[model samples]
Target chain A: MQEILQYLFSGITNGAIYAVIAIGFSMLYNSTELINFAHGEFVMLGSLCMVTFFGSMHLPLVPAIILTITCVALAGLVFERLAIRSVKHPEPIVLIIITVGASIFLRGIGMIIWGKDAYSIPSFSSHPPLDIAGAKLLSQSIWIIAIFLVAAVGLQLFYKKTLTGKAMEANAISKRAAWIVGIPSKLMVMMAFGLSTAMGGLAGVIIAPITMSSYDMGTMLGLKGFCAAMLGGLGSLWGALIGGFLLGILEALGVGFVSSGLKDATAFLLLLFILYVRPGGIISSADVNRF
Target chain B: MLLVKRYRSMMMILSVLAIACLLVASPAISASGKKPYKIGGIFAVTGPASFLGDPEKKSMEMVVDQINAKGGIDGHMLEAVIYDTEGDPSKAVMGVSKLINKDNVIAIIGPSRTPTTLAVMPMIQKAKIPFISCAAGNKIVQPIDPWVFKTAQSDILAVAAIYENLKSKNIKKIGIISVNNAFGESGKEQLLSQAPAFGLAVSKSETYGAKDTDMTAQLTKIRQDNPEAIVCWGTNPGPAVLAKNIQQLGLDIPLYQSHGVASPKFIELAGSAAEGIMLPTGKILVAALLPDSDPQKEVLNAYTSEYEKKYKSSVSGFGGYAYDAVKILAAALKNSNGDKEKIREALENTNGYVGVSGIFNFSKTDHNGLSPEAFVMVKIQDSTWKLLQ
Candidate 1:
């Protein structure tokens, strides 16, 4: 039972990261209707940027994280204005291809910059194990869960209460209507890009301390995030949270009960089964566009 | 004046044509006189497994530089034509074909992963070029091909070493966790087949996918079995995740990992949990932990110093094995005086060639340069490896 709890805790920790990254994916897709395949590369860049700034440059952790997120967020904005804006007038398939091409291009650039070596950011907390109900929990895991929850709540509040946030949501619903109402739809779209990239950067900052940062680290994480977003209904923020956490827990349970080698396949299999049953996602259709 | 101008233009055109002809003929004439001895290197270089290939390529470059510095091999400069296999077997075969048919290399040196090496083996045999794999799968050299050799010790040898180390601790029940790749599958087979011989019982076995980040579920099942030790066989991120999960579960049992987890990145990723983990690897690593006067001491010291200076990072077992591969190949080439058949014979006849890893004794039957005697159990202590008694 204690062992199960440990697995549950670690699963939640990992799931929290997936949830955060999925939220980022949903936010961009919601506002811009663009599937940012390169979103995971933003996370990779964030982590690599932090490693370079902190691990190599010996900068203070706070400053390094701030610089990483800011740089990555700016990169997202640039990517939007430069690469994505050009394709906005094109078909959705063309936009998808552009994003994927951008993903590959960014990955190549990351390899050149980071030299294809794995790097780790030192943990924010002590490296000691914490005893909880006869199971050991890493201090970093606690930080991961706490940060994810805080970010989720903060985002919920921002969307529900803030004026700028409402304007962004209005833009997502219909850009023409938002523009007619003087919401500065273009700026709102760029803002959404910045917000999503920042969230991905934060996930990178937190997860890099545990999973060493590599140029290709984004590939799997990106796929999992995409699966999570789809599972939750791509535009539903709360659904993304639920979907991400559920997927993580199911993967943990699958690896425990089923073959460990099939853990990844199990998640995809579940996604397929869910899609087959609902034809949409785990979330209700009425709430599909509730970003 | 017009005739003179025509003459000048014709002279210019003729000079340009003469230069182009010389440029085309120069390389052919050079090639016609004496062929450059070509060695093909197929490495990952740009993929998920680039970590392994990056260091291997560096070592290859270092060896080539050292050899060239000494005025070439047997009066002819040795040229290494490299192809990136991208850690895929299909690409590895393509690389082998390119090397054999296009580059016409005398020998091929890798395709680092076991699957890639195995994929390219039939082609290597068909082409009759000596193939030396740097991967650790025991089956890589089995049913020994007359033209194939490997500097990597077999998984059986490493697994036997693991069992021996566990047996010394009187640990009888062991759980196995491995990746589903060829390397991990090979390790699983070796462990299951050899555990009974070592007086150990298999308590449980679990596997995880290559890209899995959370392995807590598998660790949970293995913990339920209450095995004396958990044996993990996988590369980087996977093993690191396993160690983290074990720490999270607060499992105090010893964890015995494969040499794949010997990189410093493992400890860095696992944090404090990496301590007390025992892994069997080539002795070339943790050489400093061995007794100072040991027979392999001098070689290890030299390699450690040179590699540290060259790469600016602490060397791992992969680097050590690569170093040994180059040195062994160089020795064989020197002894054979560049005769391809004689070089193959000399490599087969290599006996008691002491290296940083172990004393290699290659024979016609066994292509692996070392036996089980080559592995030493090392425990991670305070982020550094300490040789186990």
Candidate 2:
């Protein structure tokens, strides 16, 4: 009834955020074949940057959003150049380890800059909640869902229609082949990091009003986003969307019908069960090149 | 042979001068006629609980400095040896052991949070050093260890304050949601145990992780039960999130927060959603609003003004715990002359000393020395605390 619908709305709101983070994960994984562990820190920086821009600086919403995304995207590029590219050995495990170190470094920097207090910004619009069948939906939740849709559609079109996007896709399929095809694989990797971090930043900005933002907020969000990416079969774009929503819905339902205390355990247990059964993911078969 | 003898004689002079310098620099022999009384402080000054420990550390140092400036406690100037616990139990234990065995402090105060305090309790008892904890858990003093005392109002008192307010409002069948941590767990225990006494029934009990981002689902579930009021217990961010989630979900019933959120930081984090949210807290938040005839009015005004002037920040009740703890220790030191056993005995016999948190009355069986009256109910109005009448 109304309660179920309410849980669904709540799930979708969180699901959209997880979906954005998962796509960020998938982007870097595709181009570099390296999971960017610091991707979540990009999200943290994004949210905090928005707090500084929109909350403290008192800039209008759209400009603040653009500045936040550009700032995080630049940070992503610098991180790639400094941490990822400076590695002596280009081994995947070594690069992943570097990203892990980068994440800790970024988190420490974030703490120093922002301190440990949690801060919130005003929502995109100051409208009242929309009542649908007795379940309340904030205007910000609608904006989040719309933003997710736009990002998904925009990314799909970019990959299908643009030369750079296709080059990045080709690089994901095979680095040697992409190089042979004159894709400039190194540039593609750098572009992937920038694009993914921008997306993560956007997610952080939108969700800040809801979740509030702090130095350590990125760790859990990043972990959950990684879970969503894996559940969506890693590199599958649409699959990430579905996986994020599914995880969110499952968590909400678990908290609603089952014990609330075991909410995280429930989502993770389902994740383990799915990974064991499918070995790939729910939508793994749809994306042949991902494997 | 003559040149070597001259160099050796100069080296001997230099060695004697260095030894004299070392002796002059050593703390054992001070310029003061009497030996300084060394008091140990353990606080989580640089970690997640820094909000509590930072202020506690500052206030304790401020008290010590003020005491030393006025000559000394019976000609023995107070020296504070403080260590950062980083909110970790192992670190706290390490700090306390060093404070006891290495520094040989006659008395110790604080290890900030409940878990750290509990971790180091047995060791303090074994060492037989006078300890005053700043954590609010009832278990710290419930068993009444002769060596351990605390200044923070126990969770039982805060719970009683909440239930008393609920009783006055004729509210029954309240839902309880608490963060799943030591502070929340202790508050939840008191809320459940004392509900029956207040003729209140806890319709639903739920818990959320400390770092949870959203709590809409939990509130939705609570809404199904339709409790008269909801009590959410946790420190900042989680309770702030819960407040925002409750607003988003439009669960319009009365919402009560724990004393954990009794800070301006909570108001800023919760934003407009903080309106009308009530909690039991120390009188420091509403010291300006207290009537003149109140017992704690003068002390609260002095401590708040002094702390705010010194620290350049609004005074928090968490710091008041340390302020009261140091004042209580100084009272004991006055009676004992820095004797450890005498300090312990003196602390156990403290009577009617007005301080920031409350009037103190300690006994052998009751080491905490404050009642439920230590807490007052306050509501958030317009992003500020409004003392509840």
> Candidate 1 lDDT, tens digit per residue, A1-291?
885786687678778888888899989988877788998898898888988888889888779889989999999998777666644245778778767866776787788788776776667766677777877777888888888888899998998899999999999999999999999988999999999999889878888877778888887788888888888778779878987888888788777767676788888899999888976678843655576
Best by TM-score: 2
Among incorrect, acceptable, medium and high, the docking class of model 2 is acceptable
Q: Given candidate 2, what's the lDDT at residue B381?
A: 90
Q: lDDT per residue, candidate 2, A1-291, as tens digits? A: 999998898889989999999999988887777898988899999999999999999999989999999999999998887667655568999888778877877776787799867888888898998999999888999999988888889999889898888888888888999999788988988999999999999989988888778888898899889999888888888778888998988889989988888988899999999999977787784555652
What DockQ would you assign to candidate 2?
0.27
* TM-score of chain A, predicted model 1, versus the true chain A, to 2 decimals: 0.96
Residue lDDT tens for model 2, B1-389:
55665565455446545643532212222236788899999998765788899899989988888888888788988888888887999999998998899999999999899999999999998999999999989899989899999998888888888888899999989999999889999989989999999999998899888877778889989888899999998998899999988988777888999989888889998899999999999888888889899999999999888898998988888998898899899989995877899999989999998888888899988988898788999988988888887
The structural similarity of chain B in model 1 to the true chain B, as TM-score, is 0.88
Q: Residue B264 of model 2: what lDDT?
A: 88
Chain B TM-score for the candidates in order: 0.88, 0.91
Candidate 1, lDDT over the whole model:
0.80
lDDT by residue for model 1 over B1-389, one digit each (tens)?
A: 65665565455447545643432211111131235567777877678887777677666666766776676666655677777777988888888898899888777787778888889988977877777788888788888988888877788888988998888889999999999888789999999999999999998888887766667778878878789999999988788878877876677899999988777778877777788899987777777777876788888888778878988987776766666777777777774655678878888888998886688888988788686778888999988888887
